[model samples]
Target: MADGLNDQRTVRVADLLSDFRTLQYYIAAAPTEPSHSDDYYCEGWAALRQCSIDGQHILNCAAETRVPRVRGGPDEQAKTELQQVMLDSFSRRHEAQKIYLRQAAAQRWVEWRDSILCGGRPHSGNASQLASCDAQLRIDLAAITDDSIYSDMRSSDYQMGRWTLEDPRLRDVQRWVRARQ
Candidate 1:
């Protein structure tokens, strides 16, 4: 039981890292031209960095908890405490991501609105539509975070850490934005 618990904790920490990597990829691939402001990119970058830092902390916490000296017995309290920490970290990261996403979505909307309102395009997937799409994506992402699927995945047995800026999931988001253009 102890071995299983340790393994689960390790894997959960790894999954958090994976999520962070995906976020990094998404932020890096974000459209700077559409945003038209360094401040926007800076905010996104900061959020990604925060996610990475949180993931590292969660990994360290998992390692510490797995060590015999830190948690010697098969105490449910220890496991529960660790789980709460993981969840709290995830929640904080998700909240930060939400703020970034919202800002990005708003920027995209403004770009589209300007294009349409200025007669640049005749209602052929302009900023308003892009804004709507971004809003929907934010809603979907919020729902997923509320479901806490990532947190549950961490409790599994898979050491899936070391995220990079090339996750397919983030690519899909980029594609969605381009599809509007």
Candidate 2:
């Protein structure tokens, strides 16, 4: 424990740092194998990163003061809510996808609205990745549009069709907006 930090606070901070390191390792390995394509690994990485940051914030704020207690920790309502969210996240199918789609939609919608409304120009980054995915997208669409008997439909359609900006800065902006919300 650091100087005046209690055992609980010390343990929490250590646990958080350990979790953060684990995430960093996974992120490093994400491009290696089958894990690269797993949504669980990708989403888990994001969640762990956010959690690590939150933990760091907690430690920083409590550095000079005492740690705050979590009131009524893990009540029945909280447990039920956790289970419900877990179920919803998987069953809803588009919960995470919607965030990406909504972001893409809102950006394009805004630019189009702005251009027509105020004679402004659209951002160059808009739909940048769309070009790279063009061939695959066309094939996917063709497969879907064909007759059911002749169609090669196998599983759920993963065609999260949409536009996306390639600018790295847009991610920061998106994360910032999400944090504020």
Candidate 3:
């Protein structure tokens, strides 16, 4: 146990490097734009969010290592280099976090869209059921329309597909319901 402190620093530095690389991979793999599929977007976002946590942990580890407990330790120079590398990686990781937030906003949009669109396939296909679905959907939409996130989403860099951005929202589902009636 004489080398325990050195061993702990070694382990922490190794963990920091591993997490740094994982953060880079997540940033590289991140979608250029949000996907239409909720599952796809959610899965990707979850991975990125986890990486964000890892990145933060890396930063914390780097800070701890930089505390200069023993200035002339054998690995001091190596630790200094690692700290610089970690700092550089952190900037890229911050950009990844922005992407993560935009994706979360995009996912919210998808959920709202799905809530309205899923109303079309009731088992009964009866007018009463269709009307009930529409009523609930309208209420749901109304409840969320005033949320400022949608406005931020409008200004965000990602593109919503043509089908989603069309005028008179819920057009497709409304048409289907009218046809059924």
Candidate 4:
């Protein structure tokens, strides 16, 4: 009974370490959204901090070790670069939305007049209303697309075939399987 209990504890510890490692990897790889700088990073950091607190031993080792400046080998650099590009593109789109919203707000009267003259129906009562509506629309659309893309990227069956260790429990299982094999 004591042996079984010890084995269970060891397994739990290993799982915690694996989870810690996966969270660290995510912090290093996930991109920021331009709509709110540091939002995603803050969330990721908080998660990592929690993992560190829970997995003290693994966290200590990670803190002492220096992660390489580059992730993956040269062979995978292209894929990494591509992912970065996609992230940048999304960030730019979010920025563009903000700029457009601001401009639309500032020129609400002109926009309304132009749209009305161009045979489009007016959506709001005043400049502020129009701006708020526009901003909401942009935010909603961006969020939908962003969520879809992020979901696809995080999917277990994503086609790009990059190594993602998002789930700590899975990492533990993988390590144990490899060790046993």
Candidate 5:
């Protein structure tokens, strides 16, 4: 949110920190399963999104109901101290929430690695085809990176005489794929 020394995006530092946690939620969810799902990751995706919504809701509610600012007075002094205590309490809760989300995300990532590396099909379609050369190639290139390229090839567009495998783009991609192997 900060731009050099100013708030470039006009976003508060607290908001930026919260957004970072939301990203963390997504990363953690990957291990839980389905961050690599076909067409859609389903469960992991939904959970991460829900985590983001929940976090945002918490932040927004806190902001919306912020304690009144203290100015000056013996009475105001006591109010200010109370506000400080509440703020500290909220900070602790926020930190706890962040920790929970981070741990959840890390656990999911480890699970995804275990499933993919140890012969479990966590996601269908290409994710399940990780063991085969041809399948992996298609998964990484056409399916994962370029849906149109994969679909066109699957629908016999190459046989239409307009998109030959010998084309430079396809050839280079094929070469790159082979090189990785």
Candidate 6:
């Protein structure tokens, strides 16, 4: 999706950086309300996933040796620019990944809420079937929180440290899920 930033023309680092910043702002401002459409969660999650991919690509580009004659060669200035761009992309990606996790939790909370409202069981109601569904959702959540994204502190390129800060909305959702369980 972001290939255009690198492929459509000369790698315009400024344009790429602008795109990253815009996405970061969009993700940060995304609605966390339950009343918001599923589209918001879907779009945000997709965007974050794409950001992770693009961030990794940028990191890889930064790590590669620059040949002297091809693609304008590598210079000290170019290296520094790449470093800054990669850092910015990764730093934003890390935060966006956490937001995606919160969205997943919120979506699950909504599912649980619906199930409860339907008299402690979903329409499918088969224990084995529900177990399978739960497993799938858990797997999906795990993917978003995977080591490549947010779960591993080592993967955090920016010194954000461990994800220790609490998201109050997430906490409330967790509490509700536990109380119902």
The prediction achieving the highest lDDT against the true structure is 1
Report the C-alpha lDDT of model 6 over 1-181, residue by residue, as the tens digit: 1222222122433433554465555544543443434434443334444445543443333322342332433444454445444444444344445554545554564565446445443355455555554565556656664344443533342244322222123333333323332
lDDT of 2 by residue, 1-181 (tens): 1223233333433433443344344333322221223323332234334434433332233111223334545443343343333222221222122222222333343334334434433245533433333333334334332123112111222232211111113233334324333
Better of 3 and 6 by lDDT: 6
- For model 5, the superposed segments whose C-alpha errors exceed 4 Å read 1-41, 62-72, 75-81, 84-99, 102-106, 109-181
Clashes in predicted model 2:
0
Candidate 1 residue lDDT tens string, 141-162: 3554423543433333234443
Candidates 1 and 2 compared by TM-score, better number: 1
> What local lDDT does model 2 show for residue 85?
31
Instruction: Give Cα distance to truth, residue 1, candidate 1, Å.
Output: 8.8
The TM-score that candidate 2 achieves is 0.20
Alpha carbon lDDT at 166, candidate 1:
22
How do the residues 1-181 of candidate 4 rate in per-residue lDDT, one tens digit apiece? 1112333333433443453355445433332232333323333223333333433332232221222345555534543443333333223222223323333332443344345435443344555654554565445434534335334434632354433333223334334223322
TM-score computed on alpha carbons, candidate 3? 0.32
Which 10-residue window in model 4 sums to the lowest lDDT? 58-67
Candidate 3 backbone collisions, by pair: none
Q: Which candidate gets the maximum TM-score versus the true structure?
A: 1
**In terms of lDDT, which candidate is stronger, 2 or 6?**
6
lDDT of 6 at 44: 32
Candidate 5 lDDT, 1-181, residue by residue in tens: 2113222112223343553456445544443334345514444344445555544444343332445655665455544444433333324233324434444553454355455556544346545433353233223323223334434433453354332222224344333333332
Single out the weakest 10-residue window by summed lDDT for candidate 5.
1-10
Give candidate 3 misplaced runs (Cα > 4 Å): 1-74, 119-181
Worst 10-residue lDDT window, candidate 2: 149-158
Better of 1 and 4 by lDDT: 1
**lDDT score, candidate 1:** 0.44
lDDT of each: 0.44, 0.31, 0.41, 0.36, 0.40, 0.43
Cα RMSD for candidate 3?
19.5
